[model samples]
Target: MDSANSKITVLYEAPQPEEYLQLRAQTGLSLKSLDGAKIGLANSIFAVILRQEDKLIGMGRIIGDGGCFYQVVDIAVDPAQQGQGLGKLIMNEITTYLDIHAPKGAYISLLADVPADQLYKQFGFDYTQPKSLGMYRLIAL
Candidate 1:
């Protein structure tokens, strides 16, 4: 099936925790422990994409302290449905939410993986260099 022409719908809703795990694995994103996923998702604002038959194809989420910081995370698309502008659709919904709900001077951020940074640049995200850098440390279970 040609995903480009297939009817795709982007919904401003969170995927089920199980669906979130499946989509993350399919898209090669880091796997989240089920217990962790449950807690994290409960605090996130999400956008989910569905293909023709209601197949979950993509999703993105904003997780943060709600008032001061917001990080865009879990942007993923089914491998078969990629290159069909689904990522853009996901970002459009995310940014729309930010524009409406983010407080003035709020810090919105995302960690784009390699070439995916190009996609995010279109949404006005720029590198924070010469002043601050993005970093993280994974907790061992």
Candidate 2:
């Protein structure tokens, strides 16, 4: 995670809507409509984006009410950029943000996709399964 290239630039901000969509699409994260991307980026409690060679290479976000609850979302790195600890780079930025901002007893949560869940665990995240289950229903619009 900390092993990312020293020269890579990390910005504590969400990327533009079009750039966000492209990075997600490239990284196999779910695609979002232009309007949805715009709104989501605007609403991020905190965000981090990494760029190299003037291209968006990775990003992550935190979203939720300012207090009590927060969810980690949209952690992605371009497929071509995967396996280089870029995801960890993104997570590192996110946890740093949370540590500075989230209050005591704050509930930080994330829907960790398989394999990636391993990455989350390194940052002190764990599964709630066999005791609690994670579930979701996509909104239709």
Best by TM-score: 2
TM-score result, candidate 2: 0.91
Candidate 1 clashes: the total is 0
Clashes of each: 0, 0
Specify the highest-lDDT model's number.
2
Query: 29-141 in candidate 1: lDDT tens per residue?
Result: 88788888888888785555555567788888998888899999998988987887878888888998999999999999999898899999999999998699889999865
* Candidate 1, superposed: residue stretches over 4 Å from native: 1-6
lDDT of 2 at 39: 92
Candidate 1 local accuracy as lDDT?
0.84
Deviation (Å) of 141 in candidate 1: 4.4
